[model samples]
Target: MTTWDLAVVGCGPAGSATAMGALRVDPTLRVVLLDRAEFPRDKACGDGIAPQVVDLLEDAGVRGVVDGHVPVPRLRLDRGAFGVDRTMARPAWVIPRTVFDQRLVEAAQAAGATLRRHRVRELAQPSSVVLDGEVEARTVVGADGAYSTVRRALGLMPGPMAVALRGYAPTPANRANAQVIAFGTAGQPAYAWSFDRGDGLANVGYGELLGHRHDRPTKAQLRERLDVLLPGASDGGTGWKGHQLPLSSGRWRPPTGRILLAGDAAGLVNPMTGEGIYYAVATGFAAGRAAAEALIAGAPASAGARYARATRRLLAGHLRHVAAAAGLSRHHRVIDAGLRASAADQRVFDDLVELGLARGRITPTMARGLARELAGAARRRPVRRRR
Candidate 1:
């Protein structure tokens, strides 16, 4: 058995990003990347690559892959009765996961991390993982996704999970540059989205929070809603694929010991926007740096604590707001009012967009909007002074 310095399980964005970050910190470190599937695998996602993802790719030296992707400079928020198109401060990209993930894997291999195609069966302590056999390592980073084998083997219970259904549709020539996010309507407790893929195609999807008041939509129901929202968008020939999104609602506990967890394995998805790519890359970077420093200090056991603290510092405030917003989402009327306000006020719309991106902290603009809404509601209340 060839002992390695570090072993990263799962070679998706999180895994590849971890390997790349770790190797960048220490070129001499021996790193092995493992995954069950081969390269160019397709993932069920809306494929909305946010600006933060582009930033991470650039930092990882993989910006070349995004060169030909469609640039989405604007986003339309639709709430049935009202809709508004707001220009994004930083443009996003619409790239299929098959292309995006493969590029990350190649970038990791280019950074000198060895890539191996093998299914991980179990994980053990003392920095050892069992695939075909027991492979010993000084440290292990689990970047596997929501239903991670590492997380399950380690007995880490996740928080609320969201289910999403998505598929590709032929894009209309006139709407090739359009990106739309539509809120749920007619008793549906989810949201739908469409992103133009820059190749006469669009990725359409819908997601709902499980265990909510309403039942999860069926595949046929999801397609039906997509057809209604995005007229003439879906081909109605291909089937929609569903995936689980593990949301971090500030209740998830981090793994302890020489082993560390990152990305969806750690339940780092945003509770509000269902955005995991940014958290995946961010946590991967943090885990890699922490693991490297711990190894260099000859205290591999401290890696978990370091990673936990770093991730909390990076995600605590953001997740706090996400949890609050998710709570507000439970009230349909509140969301409707907020959407109306956002559509009418550009300042409110920009603030909401910023909040969705997690780029800014709570600001006065948000507070003012809430206050105005409350004041208007008070004025609309009927008086009972005669009694």
Candidate 2:
């Protein structure tokens, strides 16, 4: 049996990014990437990448792909009767997961990581994954998404999940060059987004915290609202998809063996916004580097634990901050008020998505700006002019 340096259990952005980082640290280490689905697979996602993600791609020797990313600069946010419009000069890209995930996988292969297409049926720890009852490696990375098999094998329990649904459509002219976020006041925290894909197409989706309802809107009911929002593009829409975002950051303990979890497996996605791609990619890189260092230091079994500690150090505070924000979002009335106040100043909207660029916490400047705007809005309103 030939032993390999690492086996990555998923081919998503996180898995591929980790493999690339590992190879960068030690080019000679043999890395294998395994995934149940093949390249170019479609995933239900908002498909927007922040500029910071661009930096990570560049660091992984993938600048060419980042340069080719589709741009969406204007952001429009709505919460009930209040709304705000903002332009993003820093740049955000709308790269479909199909194209984006494939490129990352190919990049990993080009960087010398082996690609394996097989559903990972099991993970027998202490050091091995049973993929289709076969392939095995000394060290493993579980980048598999929500409900990750690797996480399960490691006995890592995930926290509550955020359910999201999305699909592709013809880019409406009115929606071109901008993205839309509509917040729901009553129910399981619903929000619909429209991101222009630049190729005469757009990605539109709705996300809500699962099992909580405000107005009896079923999945179909909420989707119908989206259909109205996107207009002509929503007609003949056959692509209905949904996925879960694991929010709890899980147990923070990788299995007591040479297996580490990355991406959704590690529950790194933000609870409030369902944004995990960038964090997953960042943590995956950290994991890969830690694993490679462990291997080079002649400590294979401790690699998993080392990866966990490194990932926690890199993300624990950020996760806590995101959780606080998400909790606020759940209180719809307060968030709605915030959104109304934010309309006068767009930085509040920017701070929401740009949390990644801000290193997870909203800056004091942004916080003070938001506070002033809210206070001013409160002062400006006529004292209950009841007609």
How well is each residue in 327-351 modelled by candidate 2, as lDDT tens digits?
A: 7667755575556555655666566
Tens-place lDDT digits, model 1, residues 67-182: 77879887887777777777777777888889989988888889889988778887666445444465777888888898888888878777888888888877766556878888
Q: Give the TM-score of candidate 2.
A: 0.89
CA RMSD per model (angstroms) = 2.7, 3.3
How badly does each model clash, as a count of residue pairs? 0, 1
The count of residue-pair clashes in candidate 1 stands at 0
How many angstroms is residue 80 displaced in model 1 relative to the true structure, after the best TM-score fit? 1.9
Cα-based TM-score, every candidate? 0.91, 0.89
Give the CA lDDT, 0 to 100, for residue 320 in model 2: 65
Go through the candidates in order and give each one's C-alpha lDDT.
0.77, 0.75
> lDDT value for candidate 1?
0.77
Q: How far off is residue 307 in model 1, in Å?
A: 0.7
